[model samples]
Each structure stands twice: as C-alpha cells, then as structure tokens.
Target: MPAQNPTGLPFDDIRHLVATMPAADQAAGDMARARQGDLLKPPGALGRLEEIAIHLATWQGKGMPSADRPMVAVFAATHGIADRGVSPYPGAVTKQMVGAFTDGKAAVNQICSAFDAGLRVFDLALDLPTPDITQDAALDERACAATIAFGMQAIAGGADVLALGEMGIGNTTIAAALCHALYGGEAEDWVGAGTGSTGEVLDRKIAAVKEAIAFHGAALSDPLEALRRVGGREVAAIAGAILAARHERVPVILDGYVVTAAAAVLHAMDASALDHCLAGHVSAEKAHGRLLEKLKLKPVLDLGMRLGEGSGAAVALGVVKAAVACHRGMGTFSEAGVSDKA
Candidate 1:
C-alpha cells in the first residue's frame, strides 16, 4: 500500500467525482415516478414509494434501476483512548469482535447473509490475524496507506454501494471528539455511551471525549490531521472509503453517529463528499441528531438502535433495493392512460 495518488488529481477532481453521481440516480428516480403515474395510481397515491423510486432512479444512474448488489465494508481497529476508559468495554473487544465478524458470528454477518450482500472486513491496523472469512485482507507497512488503499480496492471489487462500520470500544470517544472539532460542537455534546455503559462510567466517557476534543482542536483544522489525531485505524479507513467512493462514483450508506462523524470530516474536507451519501438510520445517541442536521441528511430508518456494527445501514440496503425495484417496475401514467396533470 504505497502512498500514491499518482495522477495527483486535485481534491476538486475527487469532489466532482463524488458530487455528480446523484444526478444520475435522481434522473432514474424521476423516470420511475413518471412511469408509476402511468400505472393507474393517483398522481401521488404511492406516497413515499414514489420518492423512493425517484431516489433509486438517481442512485442507479438510469431511469430504471435496482439495488441488486449492495455491498458493506466494515473496518476494525484499536484505539489508544480505550486506555483512558472512554468506553465501558475494553479495547480488546474491538479486535475480538472484529474477529467474530470475520468468523461470521456477528449481526452484520447474518444481515449481509440474509440480504445477499458482498461483505468486506479490513484489518487496517493489523491488530488481528486475517481470519479465513474476510473477503479482502490487507496488512501493509503503512497503516494509513493500507487503510485508504483497502477502500479503493473495495470499490474496485464491485461494491455497488458502501456501508462503513467500525469496531473499537473507545472509538465513540475519538469519533465524538472528531465530530466536535470538525463540526464545531462540544465533545460532551457529542459523546455517548458506547457498548451501553451507565452511571459513573458514562460520565467518564463524556469527560474523556471532551478531553480528546480539546486536545485535538488545533490538529483538526485539517481534515486529514483531524483524522490522524483522534481517528482509529478503522475510522481513518472509512474516511478513505468515503473519498474513494466519491472518486469511484458510488452511493455510500452511513450507519450510526461515528460513521456520520467520519462523513462529517469528509464533508468538511470536501463538502461535495456528502452528495453521494444516503444516511442509513438515526442512532439513539443524541450526538447523531446534531451531526445529521449538520450534514443535512435524513436517515432512512429509526429503529431505536444504538448498535454501531453497520446493522442500521444493512437494513437500509433493503429499503434502497425496494426503492430501486419500485422505480424499475412500476408503471407510468401515460402507459396506463390514467391522468392529465402535465
């Protein structure tokens, strides 16, 4: 994983790449809605499904589109802040749970299996052995390079869309801190109970996030520096994936608060980075709402979920697929000779 943007494409190029794809998906959705109108339904009888069709049309770059091959890329890394007790669980759980995900013993695995999605697990920090199950594994000399490169490779590996999830107990602290610095919020405001901590431990968690935010404020002036400051290997990796997804022209599905934090950093670095994103779901964490508002994103679901295992995004995959189907399949007004509101 050499550090090479050999083309030296400006961030503008990346921004353009990321920014322009939604139009295609949008056109697709519009076409779908037009067709649905022809299907003998009232102009807006299908309700939200019409919007879904339009969204699908846009996402697929066609008038009719389907989310046939959605993909999930979950990155796992250890964090230094876990040493400060920011999380109720130990940092060891990051590697162990990632191992479990790779071993197909986690919720993400079952969800992906159920959805028939292509799943990727990356050891961006090389903290654990590459289990037999990871579809793609990269361990290189430079963690940052490898992590970013892994993102490129994931897109090249035929992921229609990308979902970013992370494992690391204290990661919420780092992510919250990054969110504060990137989005100009207080760390206490963004920090939440990761892994379901309560009482005194939660208080400590909030304090730890505030501390990290204060310490990292200077470095956070630059997006990459902010990523380096409080970001775990997995988060940094997701940042790369976000940029790469933009470059590769794919829709990115974001999970909970932390992933939104990564998207926030990416957005601050390049505002157009958000153009390709479809927010998966709202998290129970309060920080998520603020971050989502900052990003101006509306989540597709609200399952009262606090889990950060990409499960929410996985569920959104189904919705996206259904949207695609509606766009591609439903009939239009003219075809059915239904209405005259043109």
Candidate 2:
C-alpha cells in the first residue's frame, strides 16, 4: 500500500497522472515530416529547425504548431546548505532576485518581455531554507508533496508551452547531489562552481554531496524519497510542473542544469514524463550536458549560458517560434511553381 500524503494526494496519484498524460501525436508528426519534404527549400536545409517543427507538431497534436503562448515560471527558494559556503552569494540573493523578477528587472524578466512570454515567480520558501542534505532530509513528505502541487498551478492560465527555471542560492549544489543520485556518478563529475564558487567553497560543495550520498544511497531507488532527502522545494515543484504540463498536453522547455535536474526527477519517476519536453539550451554548467545526454535530448541552443532563472529558455523561445513559422508558413514546391527532383 502506498503511503498517504498530508495533502491527501499520494505519490501514487502523481504516478497515475504521469502515466495518463497524453502521448505525442505520431500522425501529426508524420504529417509535418511529409510537408517538410515538399517545402520550396531543399529537404533538411533548415536542419534542426525542421526537426523542431515536427517535434512541436507531435506534442501539440496539430499539423500546424504554434508557440504563441509561452509561459516562464521561475521557482525560488533558499537552501540551508548555502550557509556551508557552497555558493559565493548569500542566501538573501534568492529573495532579492525574486523581488527583481516581480519588479521586471531580472534577466529572465527582460527575456520574457522580449519574447512576449508570460512570466511568474514563485517564492517557494524565502523565510526558511531547506535543511542541509548532509544533515537530514531537505523536506518532509508532506511539504514536498504540497510544493509539487504548487508547481502544477503554473499551467492554469492556458499556456501553450511552459519554460521552467529557478532562483536559489546553493541550489546548484542541490542539483548536483540529485543528479549524482539519480544518474549514478562521482560527485566531482556533477559538482560545478555555482555562483562563481572556487577553491575551498567548491571543495566543500563536493564533499557535502559525497556525504549526502553515503547517507542516503540505499533509499534513493524511490524517486520521491530521493527528492525529499536531497531535493529543494523549487526542484520538487519544477518536477510537478513538468508532470502537470505534460498531463495538460502543454510542451515544456527546460532551462539550465538545476531546472534539468528537476526534469531528471520526473524522468526517474516515469520515463514518459519528458516526452513532451524540449531542452531549451545547454548551460555552461558541466552537468547540464550530461543531463541532456542522459535524457537523449539535444538542446535547441548553446549560447554558453549558465545563468538560471529561465533566461536561456526564454531566449530559445524565439528559435521555437521561428521553427513553427517555417513549418506553417512555407510554400510547397508545387504551390511555388518550382520543379521537383526528377
């Protein structure tokens, strides 16, 4: 029997939701592919843009896909591990950045405005940070479940596509730990200089991840337990949002490493959860490349971006829009009175 949640939504409920989420429309994808060959341009001339259109068509279940209503939700929280010097910035930066987001001053805000994307920031828990994973669980089962439920609300406004991002100091450390646990690798492979940490701070971050793994490795097989033990509220919420977006048939654009880590949690919970997701960009963070590889996703952009807060995803939205336009607006060779290959 599955354990009941304090929110009256058990983990099984989440599993069922994921399992029942709509699969991509294979017929629509095939139709898009057929149309791509008939476009006036040489076949495969647009490369990834052509593939992106097919992917969008499949996920949207429509012959002509449009990313007209993209939403960027930035989930913010503070981590108790920030006090351990994992990040150069103080934990207060999280709240300050959230304020900046609300005031439309952050980079994500600017990118969202430029792309005409709806933006919302969720302060998961600014007043209290999640407990250090090296000492104990970051969140209890109840809090974790509720945080995930909070993430599901991002799609209520009828967003056609969703982009996930995070704003939390020391969260890179949490993301590293979660990646290591879920993907099974050395702590060094996953750790990076988050917020420009170097020297002793980087060493401490790696050591903390090792300690947490040693303590919790046995129980990580259960994805929810792994999240409760080492994941932050924002991470859990991002996973929930991804699951919910897929359930709603809204495609998701995953941001940098931390956001991808949350998607990794969803992937772990159910292999099909990410079928409706796209890798927005490959972050400068080393683990991000590995995360994308593990998910077998090729990022739509690679601008050497490491900034979180969904800035990369927001920028990639332009590429997505172009892809959709190319698919829907291009004239066929016959319509253009052009000769086809003999």
Candidate 3:
C-alpha cells in the first residue's frame, strides 16, 4: 500500500523512553493514603475509587493526575481468521465501519466529542483510507517499528492519555487465537460473541479460532509471530502502541475484550508492559475476567458494555479525569482548617 506517515520510532528510542520513565512507586501511594486517612474525613469516606485515584496520582508522579488532553486511538483492520467465517458481520464491515468512524458518524465519535478527547484513527492493514495506515502487520519488523513510530507521533501530537479500541468484524477470532498462543490454552476459553452474533455463529467463530491456532502453532512460539499468524492488523498495532505509550510515559486506557486480549499478549511478552495501562472496564465476555486476572488489573467500570469500538474506555474517561481532578481539587486537612487529631 501507499506510504503512511513516517514509521514509528526506532527500537532504541522506545527503549530510552521506557528507561527514562517508569510507573510511580506504590510506596508513594501508600504514604499518600495514610496521610488521607489521618485527614478529618471519616476513615475511607471517599471510598475505594478515591484510593484508586490517589494511587494513579502517585503513579503519575503528581499531586494531581490530569489527563487534560486525553486522546483515543482506534485501530481498524481485517483478520485472516475471519476467512473461516468467525463473525456474524461480513469482514467487509471492518472497512466500512472505519469509514463511519473517520467521518465522525460512529458512536465512538459522539463519546469522544462529548468528553473533549482527541480522536486518532489508524489503519494498520485495512483496505480503506485513514489518517494513518502502515504497511506491516503486528508480526512484521517493519510493522512493529511503524507501530512504535506512529504511537510516538500520537504522543507528541498532544495525547496525554491513550485509549485503544479495535474495529475489525472478526477480531475476536484473532483475539482468541492470540490468547491461546500467549497464555497456552484453548481458543474456546477466550472466544465469545463479537459484534453481535447468534449462538451458532459464536460456535463457528470458536472453531475458526481453534483452527487458526493449530495452523499457526509453529510460528506462534515467538510473540510477534503469533500476532502475525491469526491476529488482526489493528490488534497488533494496538499492542505496539501500548508499548510505545509506556516508553513515552503516557498512560494507556484499555477497552473491552479485544483490547484486553492484546494487552495480555503484550504483558506476556514484557511484564512491564502493564505498568502504564489502566483497565477501562471488565467486559461481559467470559474470558475478559480471566484476561484481567492474568494481568492483575481491576477495571474501573463494569457497565455491561460489549461494544468493540472503545466504548468501555470512553465511558471510563470521566472517572480517570475525575481522579486527576480529585488529586488536585481536594483540599488537605490543613487547607480545610480541620484538626489532624485521631
């Protein structure tokens, strides 16, 4: 295809970013919460979410965590596993729906606008035109390099927080295949209804995932190869982007099942990959919970959102923003003129 924007940053650049910046130490959060407890409020009146916000603030290395310019990056591409008839919607929907998103007609568009979050779309390997479309799949060296480069550009272009969502009809098939390869289990474990399908369709989808895993077994021993084999262009791209975000010190907000699956694969490759990730929600998918457990992340929401277009992440945007606000907005007991006595 045509040349997209300059490929992602070099591997060394990514490495440098990671080395220079790391997640804030948990000790700091513990200390901050201890201070909060001694404050005038009844112990834990602000609740668990407030503690979560404080923890995130400490991670961000700021008294207040403000994702003032949060940006949403949606990767759209086709999945080879879809050829086995995994999704109810035609694979063509991947390309078409991308158009809807770009034109600002999709539900994601509305949410992004409502929250003032910048929206950036990528075509890792789709047939249509997007703001950025790279030539490599997640498994290819060029693609991985390009994904890192594009992600860096997104970060530099003013995205403080990054949200990842995918838009390929049969991406769940690719997700199931990747999960099986990385976590070493059955595709049926992670496979579930993607883009709204019937029970029979879901079964066919699961079988396709299994078949793809078997067909690509040898290549999948390598993390990148598994991505190349049955993974969708967007899924791999998201993984690369998440890694880049970590290097750049930008927090990554993860969406539902598909994005979680990608995050799991990234974490499997590099345990530190989870450092900057904020789990958006626990999707309704059966394996989503398992994936979260594997990553040791507690989601911010569980609104029963099953939409694949980053809807879960978008919904969680308010809380993340609020957390940042709380860190900065809330007054210390001294500032509020309250006694610090037990």
Q: Which is the leading candidate under lDDT?
A: 2
**In model 3, how many backbone clashes occur?**
2
Candidate 2, 1-342: lDDT as tens digits: 122323565665666666667778899999999999999898899999999888888888887888889899999999998998888899999999998888888899889888899998898869999988998999988788788888999898798889989999999999999988898879999999877889999999999999988888788778888888999999989998998887677888999999999998878877877888899999889888988999888999999999999999999888888888898898999798999888
Clashing pairs in 2: none
lDDT of 3 by residue, 1-342 (tens): 112334353444434443454666666567666656555566677675576566565655554456789888888877555555667777788888889998999988998988889888877667632211112233455554455455445455756688888888777766777788888777778887777756888888777666666666576786666655556557656776776676555677899888888777667666776877889998887778888998999898998878878878987887888766655566778778887655
With candidate 1 superimposed using the best TM-score fit, by how many Å does residue 50's alpha carbon deviate from the native? 2.8
- For residues 6-93, write the lDDT of model 1, one tens digit per residue: 4554333333434443334555556665676666566677676666556545654666655677888887776656666656787778
Q: How far is candidate 2 from the true structure (C-alpha RMSD, Å)?
A: 2.6
TM-score of 2: 0.95
- Best candidate per TM-score, number? 2
Ranking by lDDT: 2, 3, 1
TM-score for candidate 3: 0.84
lDDT of 3: 0.70
Worst 10 residues of 2 by lDDT: 1-10
Candidate 1: what lDDT? Answer: 0.69
List candidate 3 segments past 4 Å from native. 1-40, 128-139
